[model samples]
Target chain A: MNTCKRIRQHLELADFMAEDSFSLAIEQHLATCAECRRFQSEMLQLKHLLKTEQRVSAPADFELRLQIQIRRVRAEQRTVWLPWIPTPALSALAVVVVCTVVLSVYTSIPGPTGISQDPTAAHKPTPNSGPVQLVQPKPLKPEPAEGLSLVMAATGSTEPQNRPSPRSNRQHDLNPDKVLVLVRDQNNTENFVTVPTVIFGAQPVINTNAPRTEPADDAQHIF
Target chain B: MSIALSYGIELNLERTIPIESASDHELVAATKEGDELAFQEIVRRYRNPITNFVFRMLNDYDRAVELAQETFLRIYANSGRYEATFSFSTYIYRIATNLAISELRQRKRRQLFSIFTPWKTAPESPEDEQMLDLPDTRPLQDEDLIDRERRLALSKAIKTLPEKYRAALVLRDVEGISYENIAQILDISEGTVKSRINRARNMLREKLQAYL
Candidate 1:
């Protein structure tokens, strides 16, 4: 009769068996009923066996080894973000950007202007000239004017000195003495900074009031 | 000056390792502050019992040790995320037990493949071919044999149950944890834990009736 009642409370048996007063109540009930006594003995045996087996000893060095592993894993996690923070590829990209910017600035400087001109040359060829040529000049006599001409040549490209003179039209109306005087004034050494224009093939009319005639195309080539 | 010195001493004591004096919440708080020593203290304290529990559940020594280590590593990595909302013991046990269950599932899946092979192709049954097979290897000592058979019977019986029942039994009867903690670790209610443990125990009792 007691076993029938106790069997229904098997879930609460572990708790009741833990207390001395409740244990005495169970003991008194088991003593009065044989079936309840058998159930109590079985419960006791099973509990004893489980408790005895519960004390499983872990191997030595378990804690030390576990500590080492935990530390190693956490340290590894610290490095995980390092790869994510600034990868090798990102550093390489930064270097590429810096070098490109520096290279662009270095190449962007404008070099010294007009440093490529030469003296004693004929018509200066334009940058896009194709198969163009100028007639060769009769070599100038070894004269003191050559020194002054070279001094002007040192200024810049010969293209500037080859431009036609604005005063050449007026020179045709001047008398011979006046023309000579004008030529002397035009060739003033102090004015070597401005190279006198060369007349290639024809002499101009005198300055004694003669009318100006149109020069032939061949003579115009002196320009 | 003397009061300040005493205050400094008190502060140092508060910061020092508390051994068993500290609660799991305090240790978890320290670990969140990057205190590796505090985390190591937790591992040192719980390693043996937890390892023992996992080993019993898996029945594999190497696998239990591996899972035990992985449990603490997860604990340390996720310290900041730990809500003091639940017992730390339950959280770590859940990790260790879940890993063991996965391993068990994988092993069972492999064993299932061998089930289709015909029985005659397997080794001869000892009872059926006793004359041709080796002599009976059953032990003669009743007491020693009963204990051995009890262990074998229990292990076999536990394996036959579903993973949820096995977990509840291992946590309650095997590891001796409270039903509340078992429920927390298994993510079930206390009532469910009690029902599963009872069912597991009844199944085990039925299987081991001959030995009893």
Candidate 2:
């Protein structure tokens, strides 16, 4: 800003307070400019009148009454969280806190098994949203329902059968009710896994809890 | 927030330090530590200024004194929350200004209600009650008449100033507070304080052209 503009800025509070006085630049401006001079003089007089108006003081027993009030307030404050807050307000607050704690504790308990425990299940495609496929899947099994899926061993049975691949995804050209079993295992000597027919996107659930029985002979082809 | 547990076990601060010489922050700290002497010192220091400040805002001595006492009680009640960031004077002034503003708004609401309902008996104002208590019987001299008119005109001019500008102008010009402190007390920018003060003073100058 230019000199005059800046000088007027300082003129706002100058001489308004007892110790505040005009700067040399403002003094020079006021000395030369009649408008600035008149403004300052009038403000000075107005401030004088404002200061001269009688000041009000507290009553003789202001402190005494304040002390009693303080005690009363302190007594009320001791009865609750705040002086003006009623019990219902606190009751509402308590109810909210209790609900939050109970909900948090309930949500924190690990869920029941068989209800997708994998954290990455959130990122996977849901069965209804997209097609689910098995590794080396066979042609459509038209006999089954829409959600029921079938898996077959890719190689001979001695080799571990690639189960319905979670990462395997393909669009099958069959009816919605019939999901295809893509591969066939020719050799019967296998650690045969029982794949439960379930919804197409459903992960292959092997009941690891069931005791394993040794195959008594090579002819025992377990499904 | 209430200073919950400090009211019990009155402690004396006379031996710790001279209460008069203690700084405002130190007194607040002492008050937080349950010292009544420090709080009394604070009251002694601010009672008159706060009463006058609220009086200027409300223009009613009785209500001003009552609100001033309420302001102190609040300060004592909330002393635990007092931070060293702002000067104790600014904090107390903020509280006093808020209390005065609330009282003004309540009075405005009462006036509006009275205007709307003619059947309801009107309540006596502080001014009417004051006039009833002290009848104006004595004749005034010429000098007193002129001075009284000037003072009345000044108070009227200030009261007529908008709510936003009144505190800034009073704190700056009449109370002699610094611009920065006034900004803090009013919770406004320093630029806003300057503009408000300028507007308030210009309005006053126009209203009191004869006196000027």
Candidate 3:
């Protein structure tokens, strides 16, 4: 590096001249060049003046004042909302309130009420009722020039019986009409079980003596 | 003494921890956990340096102290959110710098407005002249007076520089912060910090050449 350029760089970074190796070369240049030497001296003096400026101390009551201020701020934050809930707790409370409002709105809407909501009310038998009977599969009658015909009995005991079978009358003690039937296709055996279609808000009472269908035990009840 | 006595138990606990040996980030972490003693320690450590920095920037003693207190308040308020992404010193200094810059901008706006509206003036009376003359009772040694004048002149020269340069110079020369750290505090590159500091020092030197 040339003497003038090197000395100029040294003057700009004179604060680190004491520790840097470039200081030696700068020193040699300053020893010979009077202008660069004066520049270096002036820069050092400026640095010294800047460093010697006294630091102002905080007032004596600073710590106490700060502590009090912090306490006041914390107190204000705590009481920011009514009932003084902290931020985390307040967030959780907000979530709970929103969920409750949503649930109440959902449940209070006018719709078909599930039977399980009031099982006792739904189980009471109506006054106009007769024993519910499950019709037995009659022997398949072969039509002339046609295959055997299997007849399906209609859902309630309102259908007329062809023959008053004694077994049909004996199993009429249990409420068989209320039992929901779920057909499980096992081994492709087409055992047809009819389920009574219940209209919402209409209570149909059927006093049944038939045993409850066992298949109803495995069925998923919507109610 | 009042503060020490008021928080005596906390001070005792703080003493047990040896605050001088703790790192800035460690103290900040403790403060984050709601340790009042650690917060007090942090205030005690940086309060004076921040006061001086703000004093140089604002050139008002009362405002400097007030702003320094505010700086600590900010640190305490934000302790929970303070991540050690940079050094604690850098973080605190950045807060102080921003506050000082904002105050200066407000002062400038006020000055601009005052220029358009004439300032209110009270009539000068004989009593006012007499009051002005009845002074010089306080004793000041020659060396101390000269030192005070020199310091005042230096401070004025520093204030003349642009705000960015002044901040960089104060942090580097007066506070002895490294260029890299000053860069972090100012959110600038180290090269920019170095250039600002050098320019600031050279400008001050040029302005105060007669005194030198």
Candidate 4:
């Protein structure tokens, strides 16, 4: 450190000596070098002045202000508990509202949009050319049995009987006021059989206080 | 065998107990456990030294305070992830010095878009202007014009230093941190730290040769 270059390094070594641990070479050189000592003294003086001069007075309410900020941040963290009230939740709510409206509108409208006012109009049978009349089977007449007070006719006997052909076998069994009959026919090598039996019983009446429409006189074939 | 076993156990316990004299490690560990009070205590203990460090580095009181607070806030936010590998002060001051350098760069960027103009008269508060005129008699021998001039010359010389040299000199000379710690803070080698401080001192000596 007696050399000018080594003395410069020794001056810098003063910065590292605060912890009181240094290489022996630097310490020995510092003991022998006057120039390095003077340099170290200047650095020490400057350091002292700077320390005394560089004091920064923080704002009076710094901690209070910082605590207030932290509290505000914590409060913000606490406000996110309500999941259903977020902006995206509003979008989800809108989809539900729209679907409900569409379903209600769909249920209220009678048929497919703009097709027809009557829902069954597409399935109504077309008018025929030969005769608009429907062929009906013979009406069943009520026969009162001996033990029963009243006899009732069957409600539906609406299909017409086909034309009779050769080699037919018909059997009839007549009772006191009712008849049981069976008919068989062979036509186009196919068999058509019919058996009719009379039944008599009174059904209990149910009284609903509603208007009753008159029954249609003509019994129409359904098929 | 018993003595050796006890000695081994003692060594293990010693290793388990961290270096408590190094308060940064303790503070970091406390902070990692989500202890806000402990963190605040750390801040209170270190605020003055940090303020002193940054105030010298940046040469502005308000900027230094702002940067110091920013540094502390960053430290608090990152405390949960802090490792106990490095000294706490070194880590934090490194963050502070980096922040200061970033601020300096931003100021330089803004100045680039603007123009440079030297103030013929430095704007001082009324109180400071009054203090500037008042003569000190607290130490008659030390209060001489030559001493005041020398102090002023040294201060001005420091202000003229480049940021790296100024920071190196301020941390090493002014803050009295060890070179190893300064090296950690500056992210430089100890040799580089010594070189920068020497260069800064030599520059100051050359600028104020007459006063010395």
Q: List the residue pairs that clash in candidate 4.
A: none
Most TM-score-accurate candidate:
3
Residue pairs in clash, model 2: A137-A182, A138-A181, A138-A182, A145-A177, A146-A176, A146-A177
- Report the TM-score measured on chain A for model 3: 0.40
- Model 2: residue B123 alpha-carbon error in angstroms: 13
Give one digit per residue, the lDDT tens place, for model 2 in A42-73.
87788789777787778899999889999998
Tens digit per residue, CA lDDT, model 3, B1-212:
12221112344553334655667887887778777777888987899999999998887889998899899999998898899999999999999999999998898898688667756364257543532342233445697786676676687778768899999998988899998899999999988988888788778878766556
Worst window of 10 by summed lDDT in candidate 4 chain A: A214-223
Q: Is candidate 2 or candidate 3 better by TM-score?
A: 3
Q: Give the CAPRI rating of model 3.
A: medium
DockQ of each: 0.26, 0.57, 0.60, 0.22
**Residue B108 miss distance in model 2 (angstroms):** 2.8
lDDT by residue for model 4 (B89-167), tens: 7888898888877877787687576445455375347643643453333433555765766666566677668888988
Give the Cα RMSD of candidate 4. Answer: 17.1
Which candidate tops DockQ? 3
**Candidate 1, residue A149: CA error in Å?**
30
Per residue, candidate 1 scores C-alpha lDDT tens digits across B153-206 of 556566667778888888887688998898889888999888887776666666
Which stretch of 10 consecutive residues in model 2 chain B shows the poorest summed lDDT?
Answer: B1-10
Ranked by lDDT, top first? 2, 3, 1, 4
- What value does the lDDT take at residue A16 in candidate 4? 31
